[model samples]
Target: MNRRTYLYAISFAIFAGRFVHGAEPSSIRVLVWDEQQREQRQAYGDQFLGEAIASHLASLPGIVVKTATLTSPDHGLSDATLDATDVVVWWFVERVVSRVQQGRLALVTLHSAHWSKPFVRLMQERAKSDALQQIPEAERATARIEYLNDQPYGKVPKADAPLAPALTRTATGWSLVLPGCIFPAYRPDGALGHLTTLLVDHPIAKDLPKQWDIPQTEMYNEPFHVPTPDAVVFEERWDKGEHFRSGCVWKVGKGTVFYFRPGHETYPVFKQREPLRVIENAARWLGGEVRKNAP
Candidate 1:
């Protein structure tokens, strides 16, 4: 088998071992971890952003929700708590990467989390895997790989610069350029953004309108520097002609990583129906609840 197929087969084997033939968990355990910046008060008021999301999730049936902040004990992620969790809806957190890779839980990163450590690491891993997949099968076992450093944070790549997560064959093996996990440009002006569901039938797009708008949001222009996603569920555009792959999913090891890019602490974007629906759908799908309910 090709390297990519082999890796996926192994991931599936590990994932399949976790469940019985016809049994699935009755309730999905969701953990919402937020940095809880004071600036969120501008939009969420007394209830913090994380707490607001937790409250909304708690109102849904078959979902068990918990809120955690930077100040929470153990940062609200003690072993006991993680052991009980099935999905993490993260604003920013890094400790769960290993757990996600182990198929113990799944991760959903919100806007700006593209720079979070966990997301970066997972993207790097995916980049390495992609690089290895390009090697000939006979040389794969012995290929030597070197990962180059990431671009500086907030540094925009020149339009003519090489795209990252780039791979080059070497005399010995390969040199891989890790994803910078940032885009070429961003504007925090809270302008309106138009969104189109690129994968309407995707579980993460369930119940979402084919076309929607974020009344207020930061604009993230693309050529997003990351490994190509397994799926791009939503695309966002601005009147100025900038566009981005707003909702993307990647398979990392035995689990999943999803990034949704329509948020800013000072905007009430999450309060809208479509964004919340995206999060809810992602949680259900990531937590295995959607698959369990599938006919």
Candidate 2:
């Protein structure tokens, strides 16, 4: 671990000690939201992928886990669920974004969830935030912001297309191109993916190896059409030379969002130690940080 990683780990330890000693809530409330697609059954057997993850988290100390799926009432995102949650893992729903932005909950999106509504909307919100920073401080209040629509879903971006989350000066103010939230290309042939920790010191990369490989996983090539991430914790490359920023994090409004790109419904990616560790670390760190700052 690098210096940053070391410091963050120490800080987390201190906070964790506090939690155990009664400084705050003893357990982090986690909600695992899975779409529960039939394809997931191939790798997960009887339980859906989300349930598998929730089960693991529930077994860990300092975390209370709940499983929710699309078939559940209110799509399993009832107000009670959100109110009790500190972090939401996997999948997405429209209502969760406001809770995230308000610092009431953090989000961890996995794999194909890159296109999920909450992730897309948060990226757009970040794009707008980035656009405003370019304006003169004095003019920001009066500057008009216009957001362009995202690229069509499943539409692969041309290599030469202007990257999304781009901004241009407009006659009135700024024209912002929302993040495509998609990538240029992908191959789902269950190729081996070599992953390297790019930000070893980041809290999300805590206790993770500097280099690892996914025995069988899909590949997504860059340029991922999203705003520059606040931090990229891990990067992945395939034997064919395609690469992607596999783990990215951003701060939108008062909360944090992390995207982990490794799961494929047909692959047992989440069953691996590293991916699960990443999610566990994110859940604990995000939940702890939010509570430490909560009023």
Candidate 3:
């Protein structure tokens, strides 16, 4: 592990130690939201993609799982629903961005959610964090950041667009920061990926092979434009020369945010055992729930 990875592990262990000793553990309430887009049928037959995931999570002990979709009235979210959820595993983004910002719940954003509103907002917040350190308190509120792609707010450039460069400040009274959201390009046709574990000791990496194959999955070329990750537990490479930091974790406000890149709507990526295990591990880790009972 690199210095950053080691530090992240130590910090997480310290945080988890508190809850490990003090009180009785509570069941984690998980909300799995799928867009239920028709394209997903190419991978999941009869079952909505999200429903398949919900089924797996429900089978696990100490988890209360609920599946929701875009078709639900109020889009499957409400004050009550949000109140009951402790961790949200989502394929698309819309209603939950505010709740994440409030630190009301943690987030586990799947594949395409890289472009989702909450993910974009998190990237922007990371940009602001980097930008603030370079300026005085006198200029923070008045400062305007120039996003590299020049896309309007809430808009991401096309997949073919160039990756934004490093964040810098301009002499013209502005901050020029790369949105750090998109990669340089993508290959949606699917590639065979070789995934390698980078942080073996992390709870998210538990029981996963040191290296594994994703027989076929979409490819995302990197340098992923987000801020430096708190921990990168996995890296994936394609035979076609594409690479991505496949599993990344970040501390967002009082809650945490995790991004896992594997699933593609047209593929049965999530149906694979390893990917499912990672999701199960992430949900428990983020929700502060136990993965195994203490003997």
Top lDDT model? 2
* Candidate 2: pairs in clash: 5-201
Residue ranges of candidate 3 with Cα displaced over 4 Å: 1-25, 87-98, 136-165, 178-180, 289-295
TM for every model, in the order presented, reads 0.86, 0.87, 0.79
- Tens digits of per-residue lDDT, candidate 2, 90-202, equal 23345566667777666777777676667777888888888889888998998887878754455667878888877788788788878868887889899999999999999
Query: Which ranges of candidate 2 are over 4 A from the true structure?
Result: 1-24, 87-94, 150-154
What would the per-residue lDDT of candidate 3 be over residues 1-295, giving only the tens digit for each residue? 1222111100011011112222246666666776676777888888767777888878888767666665676555654545444434332244344444445556677776676556666666665666676777888888776665433244445656544535566777664555746666778887798999999999899999999999878888886777778999999999878899999987755446788888677788878999889988887776662222212
* Ordering by lDDT: 2, 1, 3
Q: What is the lDDT of residue 105 in candidate 3?
A: 52
lDDT (CA) for every model shown? Answer: 0.72, 0.73, 0.65
Candidate 1 ranges beyond 4 A from true positions = 1-25, 87-95, 150-155, 289-295
Highest TM-score: which candidate? 2
Greater TM-score among 2 and 3 belongs to: 2
